[model samples]
Target: MLKTLQTIVVAGALLFAGQCFAVDMTGKVVEVLDGDTLTFESNDGRLFRVRLKEVDAPEPGQTFGRQATQFVETLLKGKSVRVKISSVDRYDRAIAVLILPDGRVLNRELVSHGLAWHYRVHFPVDPALRALEYQAWKQNAGLWVDPSVVPPWEFRREKGARKPPPADPSAMDYNGIFDYGLIGNPDTKLFLWPDCQGYPEDSRGFAVFGSELHAQKSGFKQSPGCSRPES
Candidate 1:
């Protein structure tokens, strides 16, 4: 009787271990919500909202936000993807590393293209991924075009208390009209603005300009959006 009970206990422990170590999940991408959010349907018909681990993209109205979303849409929308969940985030989103049918890693691709920032919240130090982000920044790829690219997390903080830029006609470029709705003041520590448009007026969105130096001069703030510009 005692031996029988011991055998049962061992079997139960093995079963629990198997569940805990399950790493692979197959799903079809149903939606590409943004640079980092995706919806997928599993084989068992379970729907999951996945947040890419070790990356953060811009919000829709933020600077370069639309471009980031479009980039993700081009990459994964309506495709079959395999997810490897590492953990769950504070917001209860499944944090995962995604691979497409072709075995292309979505997390690495985002960092390489500068579409997403390397998120280290639950991730251990990964030098390879960090190096990819640096390489993308150096090449001025994707969102790296804007020197004042602010991370989405920081953008949320500066959405308030942002004062309007000095109304100097010289400061305003006649040929280069800025979309104030998405402007960011890169000079200040907390680049705050009222809305999600351009700097001062909208501080929560990504900067849309291609030139990072131009973005800085145009009053876009830097907040962990990507690596600093080359010296």
Candidate 2:
């Protein structure tokens, strides 16, 4: 039993060491570029653009995009933080996990609050981050309130194929009834515009909305996947 316990302890230590980051550094956040990206200034005045590893936030044009940025700014802007650098990306940004002064993990916090997505493509194996996202979704927190919420990666890919988004998306007719009408999911309490990628062809059990306001009045929220074009 003693020998078995010793072996288990040794294995655990090695596993932890394997998960350790390549570099650890302390810095103050100078600027919040977005939800998951920030400018970090070292004590000696050196600057590095740091990206939160395994986290992706909504784009500036997407729904809740500004909120995610505001969330990070509220928590870390101008505050000192410790970062564990895992690797440097091609864009010259350090992929890291930012640790707040109060010991909260910034990456995990973002996902837990539904302000960011767990970047599974880049760092796919973090079960904690995955579970946090699921919990946020289950609770309908932040962006999760939009039942058809688009992942940042998917949003980016879709955006790349289209013309530039308008300067003021709010000016678009969200409540206006278009020719194709709206697709709604009664179970999720979300309504998607006809052009939305998540709109289903089989609308058997789904509810229909005449306009955005009609859906809202009926206790349904608009999905981020439904980016209404300018009327």
Identify the candidate with maximal lDDT.
Answer: 2
RMSD of each: 13.4, 15.4
Candidate 2 residue spans exceeding 4 A from truth: 1-21, 160-231
Error of 1 at 130 (Å): 0.4
TM-score of 2: 0.60
lDDT digits (tens) for residues 85-118 of candidate 2:
8866656577889999999999999999989987
Local distance difference test values of all predictions, in order:
0.61, 0.73
Models 1 onward score TM values of 0.59, 0.60
Compute the lDDT of residue 123 as modeled in candidate 1: 23
The pairs that clash in candidate 2 are: none
Model 2: weakest 10-residue lDDT segment is 171-180
User: Could you give me the TM-score of model 1 versus the true structure?
Assistant: 0.59
Output the lDDT of residue 70, model 1. Answer: 85
lDDT of 1 by residue, 1-231 (tens): 465335434433443445533456897877778888876666756555678877878777587678778877888767777888765544545667899888889888888887777764332446677788778877878876765455676566566223344464234232222112223443443332223223243333444542344566666655454333221
